[model samples]
Target: MRAYRYLDFITALFVVVLIVSNIASTKVVLLGPFTFDGGTILFPLAYIFGDVLTEVYGYKRSRRVIWTGFFLLILATLTFGIVNALPTPPDQQSTAQAFSAILGLVPRIVLASLVAYWVGEFVNSYVLAKLKIATQGRWLWTRTLGSTLIAQGLDTGLFLLIAFYGVWDNALLWTVFVSNYVFKVGVEALFTPLTYAVVGFLKRAEREDYYDRDTNFNPFAVR
Candidate 1:
């Protein structure tokens, strides 16, 4: 395996985004007319990061990174669960209650997050990789934005449905799903230029513009 200049950095950021987003998702926030989880604000960046990884390093490398984020997210969930279950000191009982109020929802949120992210990210990478080859890597924008449009829909709808379907009423659930999906895709569209710049820089600096021409598309494959 060849070493890259920024793969580790990008992987670190991607995992951080996944873990933070899962934790933040415990709260549903309203911004103007849009309603979404607090995680929605940062969660879209994970997709952006995914695009960059697949575009610059290829889907195989991106697959490893995705699994890294997935396992770390599970570890975070376990950590929160263990801490939440521990007995609190008398002086910190109230604080523990507050912690429970917030992070207590993390187990379920993490479950929803794990499922959604696993499926959504793999689809995103596969689409972008195929698009890169089909376009012969000509239109970078198409691959990034196109893949995101599909992946974010899967991610947002699955997560919202699994996490809040029964907890929130149907109306609010639909509203949040639409809001999150639109906002996430809009963010991808809005950041097209920045993505171009980053992808360009990485390709030059790393001397890598990977195309998954003969690579396995299996999500569980360990090649």
Candidate 2:
């Protein structure tokens, strides 16, 4: 963990925020004529952080943070559900409605997000870490873009299917899927220069570019 200074700690927090935000918004928001989901912007950034974590800090620790995010999201949802179901005073009708609107998560949608996120993030991290070793740490762009394509594909496909399969028409459903996939990977691609800049700065600033040469790829057990 000390190999990359405080990256693991920050990553744990980032992943938690990513999961919660992903659950909060699954609909597209219009930026003028351009359309994109609120989650799309931030979600891809999680991948960027995941890449930075795994690429320069090794895969094992990254896995621990990923698992931490998963557990925290689960714990949050359970706690929220419990609180929402508790008895409320009749005089607090307004407060109850507000609480339900904000804390409410359809069980199916929450399940979908969890399934997609767990798979997608791990895929992104594992692929980036492996590519770093296989390429001898060359072509940083290739791994970043390639892994997102695959990871976000799993993410978008599963999330859309599980969250909106029969709820929307085929056209809109496919549109959402394509829109999200394009936006997410597009964000990563567009941010390539920034990714490089951040990576370089962290490597030098932290004086570490860890290689997971002998890492255990287990998605459990913190290091």
Candidate 3:
């Protein structure tokens, strides 16, 4: 294994985004006519970082980061659950209730989020990797936008159905699904220029522009 100057930093940022997004997702926010979870504002950046990771470092290293994010999310969720379940001091019951209201983990939502993230991120990385080979690394925008479309669709659909299918009204469920998917893909498209910048800088800085021509696409394989 070789060390890259920014791999650890990028991975840390990616995991931090993942954990914070999950925490923020507890609130549904209304932005004018559109409604979305607070996480929607920043969660798309994870995919952008994913695109950069695969575009610069290749799928193998990106796989390691994705798995790192997955386990860290589990740890965060478990820690929150445990802390929320602990008894509060005499004068802190109100604070405890408020904390639980914001941080408590609903098992179904947590499961849905974890599964969706695992599947969506791996698919995103794999698609971009293969596209890099197919286009011979010609068009960066095509790969980024194309992969994000498919990945975000899977992620939003799976999460909404699993977490809120019968819990919310059918109409509201569809609204959230459409709103989240559109917003996420739109964010990726909007950030294409920035993605190009970061990818270019990382490639030049690390002297790496990896293509996954002979790489395995297994999601569970850590190596």
Candidate 4:
């Protein structure tokens, strides 16, 4: 298969955002009246990148990037788990404890994130690919926003419920869910213009605006 200049860069960015967002999610942040995890700030960028990837590269390549991200996340979580389990030197015990405090909670968060991300991203890409064909590639905003609305909804709801349903209060759990969904979708809407610019540039530069009309949509198929 031929390689594109920007696909690797975008894939790397996607993975970095995914990892950083998962780590940041360890802290619950409050801004004025709204309360949410720290990840909420940066996580939406991953979805935006997801939209761009599907929009430019088509769903098959996007699937590869998504699975790459999935495995990388698992590797990161395992590495953290190992480091957290190691013995600390006497003087560094406090520092180790701090590290543990931050990353110790990552297992569950990572679990929720991985599951939600896998399902959500594929759905986003698949929907956008179909929308691209259905709309005959017009109305870019509809594909981006439409896919994000459904994808982020699944992501927010599944992540919150799986990670904190029993741990947090029922009302607070739902509150976080609602807030996350709103904020993520809002981010996508806010970035629509930027998305349009990026997608346009990529299509022009690569000379390819892929439509998965005859392509297989199976999430498990790598090719």
Window of ten residues with lowest summed lDDT in model 4? 104-113
The runs of at least 3 residues in candidate 1 whose Cα sits more than 4 Å from the true structure, single-residue gaps closed, are none
Which candidate leads the pack in lDDT?
A: 3
lDDT for each residue of candidate 3 in 25-102, tens digit (9 for 90 to 100): 999998766788899999999999999999999999999999999999999999999999999998999999899999
The candidate scoring highest on TM-score is: 3
Which candidate model has the greater TM-score, 2 or 4?
4
lDDT of 1 by residue, 11-120 (tens): 99999998888778878899888889899999999999999999999999999999999889878888888999999989999999999988876555667889999989
Better of 3 and 4 by TM-score: 3
Better model by lDDT, 1 or 3?
3
In model 3, where do residues sit more than 4 Å from their true spots?
none
- List per-prediction Cα lDDT, in the order shown: 0.91, 0.81, 0.94, 0.89
Best-to-worst order by lDDT is 3, 1, 4, 2
Tally clashes: model 2: 0
Model 3 TM-score, all chains together: 0.98
**TM-scores of the models, in the order given:** 0.97, 0.89, 0.98, 0.97
**Clash number by candidate, in order:** 0, 0, 0, 0
The number of residue pairs in model 3 that clash at the backbone is 0
**Where does candidate 2 stray beyond 4 Å?**
1-4, 26-28, 32-37, 221-223
* Tens-digit lDDT track of model 4 for 1-223: 5679899999999999999998899899986666889999999999999989988888889989999999998898899899999898899988998999898765567778889999999999999999999999999999999999999999888898888888999999988888888888988999999999999999998877888888898889855
**What is candidate 1's CA lDDT for residue 106?**
52
